[model samples]
Target: MTRKTILSAVGLVIASFAVLTALNYATAKRLYHSLTLFNESVIVENFSNMSDIFETVEIEKTAPEHKFGQAYQPLPKTYLYKGEKRDTENFLEKTSTTALVVIRNNDIMFENYYRGTTESDRRISWSTAKSFLSAIFGVAVAEGHIASLQDPVTQYVPELKGSGYDGVSIKNVLQMSSGVRFDEDYGRFNSDINRFGRTMALGGSFDDFAASLEKEREQGEYLHYVSIDTHVLGMVLRNATGREIADYFNEKLWSQIGAEDSALYIVDSYNEPMVLGGLNLRTRDYARFGKLFLDNGQWNGKQIIPAKWVTESTTPDAPHLKPGKRDSSDINLGYGYQWWIPENADQEFMAIGIYDQYIYVNQKAGVVIVKNSANINFMDNGFESATETVEVFRSIVATL
Candidate 1:
């Protein structure tokens, strides 16, 4: 063929291929956007009707038991929030939230949704899942799967022997006093915590991800809020029970808790459940957990978790209390066995997640509050402002 003819033919082929590729890309992008919008729309619909569902969930009786667990018998009377009332802010107006459920005396008193969140939306729990893991540990101990709280973590996961977690005790890990140096600053992309998150997101094994840490301090000397510490606990659970975390949770807690719907833990690419912070569930199901704790580990009269264990784990005791600090900024909020003790008179404690997820249970008032949010960048000023909203909800429960 002539040179000019050959060149023209080659250019036409290349142009045609580029056009097809661009069309494919555009089509895929449109589909993704559509799906996301649909999901968001569903969330909004669910949130809009959540108040009715909250009203319908019977608060007078206890939840029925299943294979995994049962719900606690709800108390009869609703408590009132006598504190100062605040504005009722919608979740979407403040931040990205899918659902919020509040229960008072076993009856769902306040339930709401925003940003297309629905009762079925399985939003990420972030660090809040740590407290749930701690609950599983309690069950493991009571069932004899784990011998004792005093047992060294290394006994369960031997690979940690030469690591920073070497000398850390189970109690210390539970209380987040592992003293291992970990940068929890989520704002800095280069921080250790962020690096770890990236590794997990890229499909690294939980064990291998943990083993890459360098020892920074002696175990149990200080309270260091590190997410990896919880993963170590997950390893301990897996080693002790010879099962995956998801299986253990399903068998020991989820099924028994009388969970209304099956809840799934967000798994890594390799199918390893993100034990540190990948839990997701319906808002009602999350409230069920809070109610379970408020009932002192009893579900329909069956002691799924030992009462003593729940009391001891949630109580602000050794390794958790900072003596002589009554709301002092210098004193870290009392932390216990993966639970957060608010600086309140009634010893109100909560399970808090990043970006505003919360499960606030007040045994004194027989109230439980569960909220989920996606507040853009972590540690935004909005997070601090959100606390006021939580307090407002707490007040509303006290009045119920």
Candidate 2:
């Protein structure tokens, strides 16, 4: 070979190596960013800009957006907690709330943004996305896609056979009673939930991760808060409908809701929506969903979700699913097809997400409040923050 030709080949190889190195570095940086995403200094920004840190699928908003009537009222300045009148705005600040929107009777009573976020920012839904997934699942079932809630999930997602989800009924999974053994303590670095987070950061398949789990007990006996159960429901929805979740959800719910801006779902490596959580939307849009549920799945005089499904999914119909302290459940809150029923309920339910995200609906009071927070102290004192937040919501509704 000629000397000049050999040198040219060597230069080409060197250029390729440099390019690969740069790509590897970029990937590593992104992974690191995702790993430390919840750090106190950056969590607020991270929650609002998750699309930049992760792969996402857009749920497009249709034209003729549903606008809420505005009747701006100042939030109650004080809320009672444990017989003490605590400052309401101070509680919001201490909880690191990014946004709060209060809606009553299809009108926005109060709305505000904080922590360098705006009305346009799409805040991460976290586990509150489960309620959204549950809503669309009802649509699939109503359209004759899913035959029955009593059918075993394996009947739809055969891929889950032999996994923890095998022999688990659709109803049991919806109630988070799948008997799947999962450690959801997000504070622990080596916990299953945290490992799942890392899987997203490193571009791993959520399906594979789910299929790796083994059952801990029989299905439908106890109320365990297994987040993956909701993911399995997503798989079933996709398999039953034979359509991508985003497209189906947009057609069935998002498009019908009159959302002001396009929402997003943080996807896994294979572009699967993280139906367990990972929904992102503006706070107003979140309240719109809350309002939909408050109105028994009706929006703007049109029935979006079946009224029957709405009632069944939000009410704890079985003893095992009832709220309050119980040995059969890991949580004191009641379970209802991905919705939460708080103790001493007064026709109220909520969709709660980690780090203090909540869509609180009070049916009798005609209030729907959307609260988004980056509360680093969420796990402190065994989640007293959540209890306190719920009390705050109740107090606010009482004033209205």
Please, what is the TM-score per model?
Answer: 0.76, 0.96
Of the candidates shown, which would achieve the greatest TM-score relative to the real structure? 2
The segments of candidate 1 whose C-alpha lies over 4 angstroms from its true place after superposition are 1-86, 90-92, 319-331, 381-390
Which portions of model 2 show Cα errors greater than 4 Å? 2-12
lDDT of 2 by residue, 145-216 (tens): 999999999999999999989888999999998999999998888888988888888778989998888899
> Which residue pairs show backbone clashes in model 2?
none
- Candidate with maximal lDDT: 2
Q: What is the lDDT, from 0 to 100, of the residue 388 in candidate 1?
A: 55
